[model samples]
Every structure is written in C-alpha cells, then in structure tokens.
Target: MSAAIRNYALVTGAYWGFTLTDGALRMLVLLHFHALGYSAFEIALLFILYEVAGIVTNLVGGWLAQARGLRFTLFAGLALQIASLTALSLTNPDWLPALSVAYVMGLQAASGVAKDLTKMSSKSAIKVLVPANADGALFRWVALLTGSKNALKGVGFFMGGALLSWLGFSGALLAMAAGLALTLIAVAISLGSAMAGPAGGIKPKFRDVFSRDRKINVLSAARLFLFGSRDIWFVVGLPVFLASELGWSHIEVGSYMALWVIGYGFIQAIAPKMLRAKTREPDGRTAQIWIAVLIAVSAAIAAAITHDIAPELAVLGGLLVFGIVFAINSSLHSYLILAYAEGDKVAMNVGFYYMSNAIGRLTGTVLSGVAYLYGGLVGCLVTSIAFLTLAWVISAALPSRSGASTQS
Candidate 1:
C-alpha cells in the first residue's frame, strides 16, 4: 500500500510538471503570434497541427506504454517537449509571416504528441497504483491528479504571459525549456528503475485502440462534444475577443484566463464532494443532468450577450457560471472513462478515450477563429451551445453503471 502511494505521488508530480509546460506553451504561441499582427483565424491555424498530432499520438501511445511501461512513455513525453521548446526558441521573428507560421506549426505538432503521451501514461498509472478493492478511491485520486494539474497549468498561463512580457518570445521559450529540462531530470531520478505497467499486466494490441465497450464509446462521444464546446470559444475566440474587442493588454487577458482555469480546477477538485460521490457514484444519469444544466447555462450567456444587456458583464459574469458547471462536467467525464476501463487494459482504454478528446479540440480550434472572425463572441457561444446539446444527447445513452467490473 505504501509503495502504491509513493508511486502515485511520483506520477502525479510528473504530470504537474508536464502540464505546466504544456499550458505555458499554448499561451506563449498564441500571444506571440497574435502580437505579430496575425489575424484571429490565422492564430487558430497555429494550433491546428497541435491537435492533429494529438489524434495520432493517442492512437498508438497506449500500445507503446503497455509494451514498454509507463515510465518510459512519460520520460519520452517530457524529453520530446523539451526538444520542441528548444527548437521553438530559435524562431526568428524577422522572418516572413508564412514561414514563421509553418515553422511554429511543425513544432507545435511535436509538442502535441508530447502532451498526450504524458497524459496517457500518468492517467494509466493511477489504475496500476491504486488497489482495486479500494472503493471510490479511483475517483478521488483521479480528481486530485487532474485538479492539481489544471491549477498548475493555470499558473503556467500567467507565467507565459509574464515571461513574454519581460523576456521577449525567443528568451521566454529558452527559459521555459531550461526549467522543463530540470523537471525531466528530477522526475527521472525520483522515479528510479521501476517501469510500472498495469496491475493485470495484459499486453495491448493496436486493434484495442478502437474501444469495444459500449459505455466507453458513448462516454467518448459525449466527451468529444463536451470539450469541443469549451475550446470553440476558449482556444482562440474568447482570448482574441478580450484582446481586440475589449482592448485588454496581453497581461490582463492572460491573467483573466489564468484565473478562470484556476477556479475551474478548484471546482473539479471538489466535484466528487459536490456530487456526493461518497453516497453513490456518478453514472449516466448524473452525466445527463450536469450536461443538460451546462446547455442551459451556455444558452443564457449567449442570449444575454445577444440582447446587449451589460454586454461585458453578461459575457464575463455568465462565463463564471459556465466555468463552474463545465469543470464538474469534465471531472465527471474523466472519472467515467477510468471507471469504464478494464483493469487489464487501462492504458488502451484511456488512449482511445483521449483520442476523442483530441479530435474535439481540433474541431473547436478550427472553428474558434472562423466564428470569431465572422460573428464574434456571441457566435462562439451559440456554436458552443450546439455542441453541448449534442453532448447531452450522446451522454444519455451511457450505461447507468460502467460495464467494467470493479475486480476486472
């Protein structure tokens, strides 16, 4: 038991380090390119390859992890990120816009692969580390890992903006890369020689990436739209809107977004308590309820903005509610996917699940720029509402309880 606890802590810490760099990278690229007078849609284009790479990474990352062990995958992910950051540090700001975009896109794709590999490995480790007989322990541990991860990522966003403000683009990338390199060293030393695999030790096949479980499939589908709803507005639309339409400086924009993600993480950390998971675990009905509520909240925000009723307040204040609701929904979905994963093949299941997540982000990233360019924040919100509605419908089909057995 003590060994399990130690390993869990180590894996969680590694996740935190990786997520911090990942979040900062996003903010750095988005703000740096936007500052160069790139259009909104163009800014979105900068991240398109990032999501595309995620789709590919998740497809095979699980098989690699199951075969090689979690520590190997985790190490590989951190190393890749460091490499990507170093390469990006050499970007010459004086180059042609098209050339700069191409260079950044290719690097961003590498970072994307790094991000998912780290995520899949860390998440799968939880199943291996936690004893199966520990009822509801899975949800709590998952929440803590994910919640703390997002909070750190929020801090990273602020760090990115601050670094860019103080150090310039090239210098900021170099600084972050240096810090992450240290993190990788620390994790490598602390993790030592244990290349942990799942408790059941089942080897994963490439074909296992396509889920056979109905519950996993339904949850993955719902997850696709649920995340899409957020990124459609979040990735490019809202940040660009605040910067351009509202005339916010980079610092102000970064700070607000940072606070939002931080608070959202807090909500996620407490979601199990809020939902009273101690009394009864969340199931399909729980998902259905939260998602339906999210749909309503999204609609109200859109309507308020459309009516021009304190437009700024409507968007700002209403989004607070959105963040709160969305956090719970996401935390719930995270738990559900793990719950659905068979113990012998946790890596495979999580990999399949995040593949859907990456796809949704890709879709949303593409739309964020286009929507903001044409219809503004209101347009983004309306599209988000549609995505939420689709998620609700898909979530309704999820089994009230996961088909996976507690003992596997």
Candidate 2:
C-alpha cells in the first residue's frame, strides 16, 4: 500500500510486459525467417545489430534516465518497441533479400535500444523506490524482479511460436504491439509524477554515465566474464550437441532449453533464501565463492565430455548444478550493483554495469559459434571454465561487505 511499494510494482509490471514481448519478438523473427528459407547465418545477422545496439543504448540510456528520470526512459523504451513491432509488420514480402535483411536488422536494432532502455529504467527505479533503511530488502526485490522476468520470457517464447502458428507473422506482431500499447497507457496513468525525476535531484553530467568506483569497475569486469562463460556454451554448443550427438528432435531440444531457462529463473527467485541472504548482505567475497564453485563445475563437465564418461548424464546433471550456482551468482551480482551504486547516480551506474554485460554476451555469442565449430561442446566448456576463472580472479579485488562504503 505504500507509495514506494506501489511504484515498484508498477515498474516491475511494465518491465514484465516488455520482456514478454521482447522474447516473443526474438522467436518470431528467428522462426519466421527460417521458414522463409533464410540461411542460418543470415538469420543470425538479423540479431547481431540487436546485441550491438544494446551496448550503446545502456550507456546513453543511463545518462538519459539521469537527466529526465526513469519514467521517461521507461516510456521511451515501450514506445520504441511498439514502433519497431509495427515497422516489422510493414515489411514487404516481395522485397529484395538485401533490402529485407537490412530492414529487419534496423528494426531489430530499434528493439534492442528499447529493451535496454526499459531494463535500465526499471532496474534503476528499484534503488530509488526501496527505502535505504530496509535491511536485505534490495537483494530480495532484485531477485524477484529478475527471476520473474526470465520466467515470463520463456513463456513468451512459447507464446510467440503459438501465435505464429495461429495468426502468422504480421498478425502476431500487430497483436503484441496493441497489447503493449495498452500496458504502456496503464503504466503511464498509474505511476505518479513523483517518479519522473532523478534521485537526489542531482543534475548528472553525461560523462558521469561511466562508473568511477573501483568496486563497480571490478564487479563489471567480473560480470563480463561471468555472462560470457554462460553464453559460450549455452548459446550454440549445448543445443547442437543435443541435436547431433544425442540425436534429439528439434522439439525436444527446444523444450529442454525452455525448461532450463524457466528452471534457472526459479532458482534465481529462491537464491536469496538459498543463500540465507537475510542473515547478512552479500559482497565481493560472496561472488568470489560462487564463481569458484562455478569454475569447478565447468571444469568437471568439460572433463566428463572429454573422457566420454556418461556424457549424456554428465551434461544433464552438470548443467543443472551449473544453472543453480550461476543463478545465485547472477542474483548476487544484481544486488551488488544496486547496493554499490550511489543513490543519486543509480541509473548511470546500472547502465554502465549492464554495458559490460552486453559486451560479454556479444563476446560469448561470437565465440560460441567459433568454439563449437572447432572444439565442439568440450571446447565450449573449456572456454567457459577459462571465463569463470577470470571472473573469480577479478572478484578477488572486490571489497567485502565491511568495505563497501569505502568505495562509494
């Protein structure tokens, strides 16, 4: 019933809507284009801009959020998504291949901007809305929001596939656009004007968008590798391995992936409880411990694949363990970014942190293809172990809970 809680709810709700559509759009584009006879690499090119655009969007979006408040950026993101969806719906089936690819990529770039802008806005809003005196509340809130968002995204993937089957591409896009428009209107009316300004009334300089805090910088570096570790195998290698080596059907592979994501989200939601977060706040030490565990798990999985020791069982069981540990690591990192952030500059700090995250994804995605082609799943797992080791080493520099304030 409190104003802060209400705003948090509003922001989370809007983000949920946006994430659902974002996931759906990705599936729609991939499946639709593949069905239209586009080569796999060409289809992948359509998403390259989406990832590339995120790097810039997070950097600039932070500054924009600081200047105009989280509300502005949130609205801008939703609006841009609506426009992007509508534009995609307008694509001409008869257009030349080059023209079509360029057009879709451009629209996907717009969607990327939309995704990051809304993400930064929603996440930054949490620091503003949560009372500073509430012990351990930040971690729980961040976990819930992030976990639920991922779960919904998995659902959206299914929804996208179903919609394409029922209504085709254009109809599905238009429907999603209309649904998002309504959510946008509802959010605009419910979230009050007080949410429309930067925290602490500070007029943040554009250059302030880059983080200066040593802890933040260290954490950012760790985050880059942490995500890269996941994507290196998760993106391409694992799926291909299941399909080709295990001889699984496409539906079976898709189902397993969707379930994995949903399960991972579930683990994330419960991470705070699993880690006894309420007993104490997490810090760099916490991240270091988790990353160390992840490194061991990654190495074990790679070894199993190399030795051909129950490879299927090893992959299935190892991945489950990896997912749980990684979720906790991810949840802790999310909280730390917000916890370490200066109140007035939370938007910019979150933006800068996520920029590193985007870069990690880009790196991992490209490496996933190359590694899988040359080294297969074992190679990808080896790369993941390397990335995790780097992340663990970098996390060693992070300040402890007692030292958190010194950096800020």
Give one digit per residue, the lDDT tens place, for model 1 in 1-408. 487788788888878888888888888888888888998667767888888998889879977887778888899999999999999999887999999889999999999999999999998888777767777777788888888888889998888878989998888888888888888888788777666553346666678778898888899999999999999999778888788878999778878989999999988988888888866788888999999999888888788778877878877898899999998998888888888888777777888899999999888877877888788988988888889999999988988765323444
Clashing pairs in 2: none
Q: Estimate the lDDT of model 1.
A: 0.85
Maximum-TM-score candidate: 2
- Candidate 2 overall lDDT versus native: 0.91
**TM-score for all predictions?**
0.92, 0.98
What are the per-model C-alpha RMSD values against the true structure? 2.3, 1.5
CA-lDDT, candidates in order: 0.85, 0.91
Question: Which 10-residue span in candidate 1 carries the lowest summed lDDT?
Answer: 399-408
The C-alpha stretches of model 1 lying farther than 4 A from their native spots are 34-42, 165-167, 193-201, 240-247, 403-408
